[model samples]
Target: MKSQLLVPAVYDFLENMEFEGFDQFYEYAIKRDVPVVSKAVGNIISFFVSLFRPTNILELGCGIGTAAKYMLTKSKANYTGVDNNLERIEVAKRFLKDFNKLKFIHSRVETFLCGTDEKYDFVFVDSIKKDYEKIWYLLKPVLTKRSMVIFDDFFLYGYIFQEEAEIPYKYREGVRLIKRFINNIKNDPTAEIVFLPIENGIMVVHYEG
Candidate 1:
């Protein structure tokens, strides 16, 4: 059976929660066929921002700044969004021009993480499954007290729980890496974690050190 966390009815309800002008960008994203966070995912991110009220946020794989817009509007926090795709960053910049607290960087996340000494109160990882572990390693050193690091797409469309033989040949390697990320965090002593059943799957890791 599939995970009930992503029930269509639940997603339909969350997707309709409104933010001014969000739908325009969202519709544009769909028409352009570019990758962007689902509305349910954006709702969850907004919920977290309201609850935690973090002052600084860093987002990985910030495609077109959709998620960044949600975070900025909801949290009213300073945001740094990184994406390797120049075209997406350009679009993100255009749409996010009004928000002085938000900035988009067109650089690989690994490179950005290496060169920045800044620590953030919240970190959102929306990168590919295989790269999560590497990003996590680099992300650890930049977390502050009571910081929350959120990892999106943890369920990988339910593929993470399937047997290796059952998974498609092309996805097996990436699925394995994501599973390794789950396992490592489960055993880690320095972080407190919660897995939320909101869209695909969301994992929030609270740094204890």
Candidate 2:
């Protein structure tokens, strides 16, 4: 029940898709043990979003900037990636040196939101599950009618902890919060929601026009 099985299948499918500069970064990320968006799922979402061709993109919790790099190369967007981990930001900066359109900020998502004056056509939420709602609230005011928001790792990895007794309540609580957040978005008139069965599950929200 290792998620490893899903990896190859997804890789094979994405390997055939055409996206310039993606394969190299994907390969590098896989080898460097950098936590980026899963190649298969990331490509699918990137491909779909590329059709819209967002002009400005924001990524929260950019671990090592793999996803931001891929998004910049694939969607050709002006990308800003934020992460609280300075060490990871350094690695991402080194890895993504060639992309002048991409920028990385070493700040917590919550802190960045309070001070940033820029609005984005797309916002990607990759922060921890417990902080999802908070991040969403911070960005909600800035989202334009056509802005798209993607939340990664929304699905619970059920098989991973199947055998463990006295499971942590936080895991269950986290899942519940995610579910509730999705429901709240679905009920809102400003956004339309869809859940994709990608790597861990990505909840995509398109701001209402």
Candidate 3:
């Protein structure tokens, strides 16, 4: 449901490549209308992982492990994926059972972040838009100085830039929160952030300025 306003032919160009083992989950997600990371987003994530080779990876709101497939394939890092939905977790586990060092947990992103003593070098979050700031506050405790976090759907299908009345009623609040987050992060001295108008748009951040 991305607004075609920000989308150019680039997404179709970059997304034409095949994901050998991910097609099944991708089809399932699309057929079910579940929100999964776009292939363009997955590609950038893979590029980042290939560049950094982080030892530990974490994904918040990992729906059906679509993005995790790209991440685990690129790096040998132990992958931990968290989602509040049990059904999605089960399906993700079933789809990703072949990956040896994978762990999929059924828990809220904030709860998992608060409880874990783990440190991740790379984190991808595709969570509820309205909960971004709330989860963000709890998420910082789990990262080290070198951590890189990528938050997907920052543009919310291009409705973020639309007039409030133009955006669908259901999505209006999420768009507002994204605007709030963009401004808040920009003003924070400790955060070095980049917003890329990729598929659904992504907000990339470094934990330390």
Minimum summed lDDT over a 10-residue window in model 3 is located at 1-10
Number of residue pairs clashing in candidate 1, backbone atoms closer than 3 angstroms, sequence gap of 3 or more or interchain: 0
Write the residue-wise lDDT of candidate 2 on 131-158 in tens digits.
Answer: 7877888888777778888888776554
What is the Å distance of residue 51 in model 2 from its true position?
Answer: 0.7
Summing lDDT over every window of 10 consecutive residues in candidate 1, give the lowest-scoring window.
1-10
Best by lDDT: 3
TM-score of each: 0.93, 0.82, 0.92
lDDT string for model 1 (1-209, tens) is: 23346667767777677777687678878799887887777877887888999998999999998888878877778899999999998888898888888877889999999999988999889988788889988988888988988898877777787899988888888889988888998888888999887777888899876
| Ranking 1 against 3 by lDDT, winner | 3
Sort by TM-score, top down from the best: 1, 3, 2
Residues 1-114 of candidate 3 have per-residue lDDT tens digits of 653535467766767778788789878987998877777788899999998888999999998998998888888999999999999999999988888899888998878988
Q: Estimate every model's Cα lDDT from 0 to 1.
A: 0.84, 0.74, 0.85
Itemize residue pairs with steric clashes in candidate 1.
Answer: none
Q: Count of backbone clashes for each model?
A: 0, 0, 0
